[model samples]
Target chain A: MPQTHDDVAETTPARADVVEMVGLHGFVQLAAFARLATDAEHAPDLRAQVTISRMAAGELAALDQLETVARRVGADLYEAMASYSTVLADFDRRTPPGDWWERVVRTYVAYGVLADLQRVLSRAVAPDGRPMLDDVIADSGYEDFVVAMLGPVVAADQQLSARLALWGRRVVGEALGIAQRLLAEHPLLWSFADRQDGARSEGDDAAWLRKQLSGGHARRMGRLGLTA
Target chain B: MPQTHDDVAETTPARADVVEMVGLHGFVQLAAFARLATDAEHAPDLRAQVTISRMAAGELAALDQLETVARRVGADLYEAMASYSTVLADFDRRTPPGDWWERVVRTYVAYGVLADLQRVLSRAVAPDGRPMLDDVIADSGYEDFVVAMLGPVVAADQQLSARLALWGRRVVGEALGIAQRLLAEHPLLWSFADRQDGARSEGDDAAWLRKQLSGGHARRMGRLGLTA
Candidate 1:
């Protein structure tokens, strides 16, 4: 993990890069927590929040612990997390809560997009390192939870399908907007995208992301008793 | 795990109690996220947060997934997680940011105390149910991380020793503050506390908590290069 380039970088250290990355992870972790907190609110009662909080706390602790390990392993852990976070934070900061549908769409679409990207990125890691990445991906029970939550509501009301479908489109638009920012900032990640099998063109990654979003939205809408 | 109560008072459904417990878990999870976010700020560079976030996310997801399983198994997962979260959240929401020492101390002492309690409570469950409790308790890596974080900080800064010791005391006060609220809200938890080690009185439970806090604080302080 301790490559010569990393050692040289540590010595001459682009301080601004370091700061930016830390800021990014901070923003992203905050967004993650906010999402968790908001989701917990939908729980049946305060007890549910407590339960969710403990789970969330453990996450926080694990993040800190992993950062410590990354430091030992000579990788810039903060920068990696921050790269993702910066995009998310900016999105949240720009998009004020418009309505419940908007919020729900954001959760479903935004996370779904990120998770797809992560799933791809996780594959790039060495085989041994994949376990941790898999673990992170595994914990995103949000999709299932969202489906369960919406199932009842959708069953009761048919009109929600049309409304959410529109909301899903807007959510996809916002996601693509942020993703462009992410690509511009992270050359390594962009390079990885370029190296992908079918993503040889400049806008290929964006197109692929859109396709994923479309597919995910369609699946979720149908699950919620909606027509895409 | 659902006990049939012949007495009418015991049989009455306690919705409020359930809510309070769940809320507590939410609080703890939020605080944990906050603390992790803050700790991420101390990372040497940006990439560190990425690693940390991955770890944190995994831990959080695990906790949440486990709770979902507990819910399926009729173990009131929300209530259990909430009980822990309530104390943590109250501490986070009320505590000033200047109290960094106290924050670390609380992480060290508070988690250890809870883990010990979990160890005892794990026994109360029947053999079939004990494994899940054991898995949750076992997966908590707080002690290792705390030791790692505090070891160098304490060794390098002598002034931090006295400051952290006092901070440890304050953390206990904060814990007690939330503990009282929890006890008032959840008689089941209190009863669980009392039944542990055949203790029957509230005073006894308080004493046990105090002793645990003091010992945990001492151990953590020692790790932080302080004289316990």
Candidate 2:
């Protein structure tokens, strides 16, 4: 469960949990992308793809901070993270990429959605934790790489564009579903959702997050020459 | 075909080809190890393991040099590399590691052999190309990480040590077999062996390389509490 509070002292440990969960998830996602970037068949530019992955590894610096925070608060980082594997793994399982184009779209779309959510959620974290979160999500490093690699292929094949656009929507759908499940299962997240500055309801947060996710996804699709 | 020469000017392009072949092979080996490092099941420490993989990625810096060299000479880097793929892929196919310990041992042993051979062969390259080749092989970053990870595990289980030692030998066998195939198929390499300074024969270089490979493997086994 991940929750954030304005009164930082009282909810310090939970905030740390929130950060660890986000940071660990980011690392896991980036690591998977790093592996996929090595797929010579599907990757647009192996060098640029690898570059994006190394940049993704840059997020590990923030992961270090979150892990430290988790330790200081006596949180069992692994135990706290155990619940996430199911949802995250489910997202991967449901939307397995069949080839290189699918890989590019899935990576670009899913990571974009997660990055967007992390950006919105970072505001709820305590001040110390927020900056690092911001840094992790700040640079969408692979966006141009995806466009450059996949754009031409999509332009050449109408069938691929349609398939990829559908793939992009599926990723957004799956990611949002996981986020919803995450919010529901974790009390910390529920509190974070419920206890934000004003009386914004969970539905409102979900809607806002969804808007951001779709906006990002649409822009990414546009970049890759796939219609939203 | 990639060949080296004492006469620097005429053979400059061939020297570059030779460097690209070796550099690209090293990059491919490192890239494969990078993927294996992400396997949490066998890796002793995920963070340290990933660090080693990233260090492996650092080998790509030499890859950039090789690409430059290949382009300057109008050599198709991939085309020149096509012949060696069989041997390289065969090595991987035959010596797949089943667990984390095996992964560490295989990666360390196989990479050590390649790095050692690269070190020996780098001497034949023109002066300008030698430094980058040397830099790529110099650190052996993952060796320390493997010893730190596997030493205690093997100490706890004698049977594991025995298994790893056997595994180490198999990796060496497969690697040497690949090298033989690579030398036989590539004229540049045959020339490299045949046309080196008149005093030495191909048998001498091969024997010297074998000694270095075996000695390094034996020492690594001892470090890991395994009998050579």
Candidate 3:
């Protein structure tokens, strides 16, 4: 059994493990965001989004020998990374954007939804892993930035809010579409998700994920000062 | 008036400065590469090049924070980074590749030359900066990977070398093409480039850059086991 973060309250695993895991996840997430940013041609205001994402990616590789260990653990962390990667790849392949705001909105939809899911999932990992996950979540400034960006646009134009709300809904829909496929195809990750609730049935985890997404959608809408 | 790395010897300032400059440069370089990786259709082995480039980008971002501080002390340093970044952005925009090998050759031609230039330029920076530059250069791992990927293709099909040679020539042409525009537009960078040779003219720098490109082209050809 992996030691939970709460278990070693006094001394952390020398801070190195936290650094390593956080760094790896950070890299994966950032690269995912960078891919989204490319598609966010409509969101020129969010060009910095990709830059931040790339920074996250670089951090993962910088974790000394931790990256090697992450791979060796058979966690398939890299594969897990590539799995999420397809979300962005699909976005790139199907719809290369012509406008800036569309690009930003797409990014806001894709990365924002994924980040929220990871934020919650990180909590279910083992204790030692929890700290690392916490660190990863902590470093991701995407949530705050997205909310900030959405605030003004919604405040100025109610139509923008409505359109973005619909966009957000579609984003979640597409994301869930992908998640369902991933769950079916990747039994280990599905098992991991199932173990999050100590439930034997995957249905329990699926229900839990649905509730989280609904809540997330509500929070995102509120952030935009819109009605979901 | 800037402190040379040698002047600082093996003391903290020397090491700290070297690391800082290199770290920032690395960060910018990685970010630039990630942007390029998104254009992987232009590369020969899309998946591998993208993976390597993304890894390099992430590693650059994860360097110690102390290093970031050291590199930001002078506007000159930032300016050099910005100049390189501009070159990258232009390359990205003008010649977005539709094929994989073209992208690989572009990476080889672009980063390969920049790495070589960095190797030489690091010597001119303060002695404290050299080690950090060296560290980044060592960690990049791109050159070896590129050579390995290029080797098999070259040995089995001489046409691969010929095509890549042509591609390499185009990258240099585009890079120098942009450099000329930058020289005309950014007098500050041009002046700095001249100062490197103790009052060499801007024209002199252009001449030197051409010579550097010529030599790099030859080296790349040799690595591909081709006659230049």
* Tens digits of lDDT, candidate 2, B66-163: 45555545565555554454455567678878887787787777777666555545543455543323354446467787788778988889888788
- Compute DockQ for each candidate against the true complex: 0.16, 0.21, 0.17
Regions of model 3 farther than 4 Å from truth: A1-33, A36-88, A91-98, A119-139, A194-205, B1-31, B39-90, B93-98, B115-139, B194-205
Q: How do the residues A1-228 of candidate 1 rate in per-residue lDDT, one tens digit apiece? A: 112223333342333333333333344444555565554544455554444444444334334533533453455554446456446656776655566655666676776665555444433232232222223344545667667767688677767767766767666678767656665675455433313466666677767756755676567667766655
Identify the runs in model 2 with alpha carbons over 4 angstroms from their true place: A1-83, A124-134, A138-140, A187-199, B1-33, B37-49, B68-83, B124-134, B187-205
lDDT of 3 by residue, A127-185 (tens): 45443223444344555676686678778997776776666666667766655554454
Residue-by-residue lDDT tens digits, candidate 3, B72-154: 44323333333344455667677665467677667666666655554434442433344322344444566667679767877
Q: Please identify which of the two predictions, 1 or 3, would achieve the higher DockQ against the true structure.
A: 3
Q: Global lDDT of each model?
A: 0.51, 0.58, 0.51
Residues forming the 10-long window of minimal summed lDDT in candidate 3 chain A:
A37-46
Chain B TM-score list for all models = 0.66, 0.75, 0.65
* Cα lDDT for residue B108, candidate 3: 65
